[model samples]
Target: MKLVLSPEQRHLREAVRAFLASASPLPKVRDGYDPQVYARLNGELGLSGLIIPEEHSGAGAGMSDLAVALEETGAALLPGPFLATTFAAIALTRVPDKELLTGIAEGRIAATLDGTEVSYDGSAVRGTLAQVLSGMETDVLVAPALTGDGPVMVAVELAGPGVTRTVLETLDITRGQARVVLDGAPARVLGPRPEGGILDRLCVAVAAEQLGVMRASLEAIVGYAKIRVAFGRYIGSYQGVKHKLADMHCKLEQAESIVRYAAWAADESPAELPEAAALAQAYVGRACFEVARDHLLLHGGIGYTWEHDAHLFYKRAKADEVLLGPPRNHRARLAQLLEL
Candidate 1:
C-alpha cells in the first residue's frame, strides 16, 4: 500500500498543528487542561468525534484521520480528557448507546481508565479502578472487567451513585490521573474485550503521537545545534553532533513510516492491524524516548531545568513508552504475530 498520507490527511495534520501551536503553546500546556481549549477542540475542530461515525455526531473519520490529529496533539503535548473520550467513542460502537456516544462527540462527556475490574450482575457492574486518566472530571469510564464468560467491557458513569474518585499525581501533569472505586455501579455492557480491536487501535493512535514527539525533539535539537556555538564553531558542525542528529532523523523517518502504515492498517486492514500496531509500539516507544533524551542532552544545561520544554517532551516520551505496554512486551507480541 502507498505509504504517503492522502491529501485530506495532510490537510488535517496541518490544521491541527497550526491550531495547537496557538492554542496549546508551552505555557498553556504547562498550566494543564483548559476547558475552553478542550471545548474548542471538540466543537470547532470536531476532534472529539474524528473517528466516531456521522450517525453518532462525529466527523465520520477513520483511525488514520485520528492518527493525523494525534500527531499534532503529541507535538504540542495537548492536555485534557481527550484520550479516554476518544477511546470511548471508538470502543462504544459495539454497544448501542446513542446518548453516551453522542455526548462524547459533543465534548459533553469525558471517559478515562483507572484500574477497573467488574462483573455484570444482570444490569450493573461491581469493581474498582486506579490511575484513571483525567478521571477527576470525567463523566464516563471505560474499562475491561471479568464476567462469567470472560473479559467484557463496562461503561460506567463516574458521577453516578456507588462511584468514588481520587485524583492522583502523575509525571505528565498536562493530563490528570485518578483512582476510581465502583461498588455495584450502573454500567452498560459493551461486549467481549479480546474480540474487539479497541485497545489495539488505541495503541496505533498512541504510536502516531509518539512519532510526533520524536520528530519534534529532533527538530528542536537540530535547531539548537545550528545556533549554539562551541569552540568557535557551531555545535551542529561537529562530526559527533551531526552523527547523532542524522541518526535521530533516520529513526524518526522509520517511525513515521511504521506509524502511518499502522494507521492505514487500522482503517483498512483489520486482520493486519494487531501486528502493525505491535511493530509501531515496539519501535516508536523506545525510539521516541531515546530521541527526546538525546535531544535534552544536546540542548545543554537549559534542557535540564524545569523551565525549558525539553524536559516536558522527554517526560512525555518516557511516559508514552510504557503507557499501554513497554516496547519489550510489544516486541514479544510482534514476534508472535509474525511467527518469528
Candidate 2:
C-alpha cells in the first residue's frame, strides 16, 4: 500500500519544521536544557492539548498529526518533555473531566507518567524511574500503580506532601529525565487502569517518537557524509561508507513503514497496534544508533569532540531504544504475534 502522507499532513509537517527552525534552533536547544522551557514551549505551541477533544481545549488531532509534529521536534533535537507530555495527554484524554483536560491543554500545568516501579505498598509508590522525561518540571505526575483490581494510572500533584524529585544526569542533554520518590503521595486515579488496546496505543505513540528520532539521526549522518571528505574524497564515495549508508536507508524505510502503520492503527484499529509498534521499535532503535555512530565516524576527529552534535543524537537514540522496551523484548512480542 502507498504510505504517502496527504497534502494536509505534508503541510503540517512543513509547518512544524518551520516552527522548530525558528523557535527551537539547534543553538536554542543547547541553551534551553531546563525542564521549565518545555512547559513554556508546550503552552506556546498548543502542543499540550494535541490529543484532547476540542471541547476540552485540545486540537483533537489523530495520531498521524501528533507523529508529524514529533518528527520535526526530533529533527531539531529540541529539548523538552515532548514524549512524556504527549503520552500524558493521551492518558488525560481518557478522563471524563473537562476541567482537568482543559487545564492540561492550556499549558497552565504540565504532566508526565512515572511508569517504572520497583516495589509498591498499598499506600505508597516508591521507586526510581530511570528515564522520566521532564520529570522535574512537571506540575503533575501520572503514575501507574497497583490497585485492588490491577494497575491503575493516578494523577498526583507534584507539590503534594510526599513527592520528591531528583534530576538525573543523562547523556541525552536535550531531554531531561529524573527519578521520582513518592512517599504516600496523594493521587487521584485517572481511569480504571489502561489495558488491552489502550495500552497498545500508548506504546505505539512512544514508538512513533522513537521513529522520528531515528529518521532525524539518519538524515544528519547522510548530510554529514556528503560533505566530509577523507583521503581526498568524500567519505560517502567509498564503497564501505556507501554500503553503510545504504543499509541505514533501508532500515529507515522499514522503520518508517512500521511507524506509519502503527500510528494509523492507533487512530483506526487498535488490534493491530502491538505488532506494528514492536516492529517499529525493534528496527528504529538499532537503525538510529547505527546511523549516529556512522555519522560520528564520518566526521572523524571533529565528531568525537564535545562541540559536535553527533553525540547528542547518538545518546538520545541509545537511551530511547530501551526506554519502553528493548528491541529484544519487542522481537519476542513480535514472534508471539506472528505465532512463529
Candidate 3:
C-alpha cells in the first residue's frame, strides 16, 4: 500500500518538529517536563486540540494526523503531559461529556493515567499507582480500575481532595512519573473501559512514537558512523558496522509500515485497529529499544556517558517499550488477536 501523509499533516509535523527543536532541545529536557514549555506547546501551538472534535473547539483531526504529531514529539524527545492528556481526550470524547472534552480541546487540563492497582468496592475507589506518566502536574487522572462486572475507567479531578500525588524518581526524568495514592477518592466514571477503542488508539499513538525514535536514532548513528574515523577509515566503511546499520534500517522501515497502518486503522477501521496496534507495538517496541541500543554501541565510549544524546534516546526507547505494555505483552495480545 502506498501510504502518504497529506500536505496539511506534513505541515503539522514540521511545525512541531521546529517548535521542539528550538523550544525543548535535548539539553534543556531534564528532571521533568517544563510546565511553561508545555503551556506554549498546548496553548500556543494548539497541539492538545489536535484530535478533539470541532464542536469542542478542537482541530477535529483524525488519528492519522495525531500520529504525525506524536512522531515529531518522539523524535524531539519533547517531554510533558501530552501523552496523558491525549489519552484523556481519547476517552472523554467517546462519551457525551462536552464540558471535559471542551476543556481538553482548550488545553485547560493536564492528565495522565494512574495504572496503579485500582480496585472498586461498590462505594469507593482505592489504589496506589506506583508510576503515573507525567502525574506531578496533572489536573485530572484517567484511571482504569477493576470492578465487580469487569474493568471501568474513572476521571478524578486532582484539584479536589482524597487524592495524593507523589512524584517518583524515574529512569527517564524528562517525562516524569509519579506515585498516585487514591483513598476513597470520588470520581466520575467516564464510561466502560476501552470506550471507543481508546486503548488501541493509544497503542497506535505510542507505536508511532517508537517509529520516530527508531528513525531518529538510526539517522544519528549513521551520521556519526560516517564522520567518526578509526584506523584511518570511517567506521561505517567497515563491513560489520555496515551490516548492523542495514539491519537496523530494515527494521525501521518495517516498523514505519505497521505504525502507519495502525494509525490509519484507528480512524477508518475500528474492527482492525486492535490487531493493527498490537502488531505495531510488538515489533516496534523491541525494535525501538534495539535501535537505540545499537546507536549507543556504535557511538563507542561516549555513548555511555551522560552528556551524550544517545543515552537520552536509549532511555526513551526503553520507556516506550513498556509505556503501554512490553513487547512480550503486545506479542501475547497479538497471538490472542490472531486466535492462534
Candidate closest to the true structure, highest lDDT:
3
Give the candidate number with the greatest TM-score. Answer: 1
Give lDDT per model, in order: 0.83, 0.73, 0.84
Q: What TM-score against the true fold does each predicted structure earn?
A: 0.95, 0.90, 0.93
lDDT of 3 at 118: 82
Q: Candidate 3: worst 10 consecutive residues by lDDT?
A: 114-123
Worst 10 residues of 2 by lDDT: 117-126
Off by over 4 Å in 3: 115-124, 145-152, 192-196
1-340, model 1: which lDDT tens digit per residue? 6578889989999988888888888778889889899888888788988877788887888888888888889888888878767766767765546787788888888766543567677677776666677888688888777877788777888899888888888888787778788888888776677466866787898898898889889988989998998899999999999999999999999999999899889888889899999999999999999999999999988889989999889988988898887899999999998889
Higher TM-score: candidate 1 or 3? 1
Predictions ranked by TM-score, top down?
1, 3, 2
lDDT of 3 by residue, 1-340 (tens): 2268888888888889899888898788764578888888988779888988998899999889988988988888888888888877876666536777778778787877655548876656788887878888788887787889888877777767778888788777668787888888888776677645767888988888888888899999999999999999999999999999999999999998898899888888888888998998899999999999999999999898988999889999999899997789989999998999
Alpha-carbon RMSD, each predicted model? 1.7, 2.6, 2.1
For model 1, state the Cα shift of residue 53 in Å.
Answer: 0.7
lDDT of 2 by residue, 125-191 (tens): 5555666778876778776777766776677777788878888997777777777777777767666
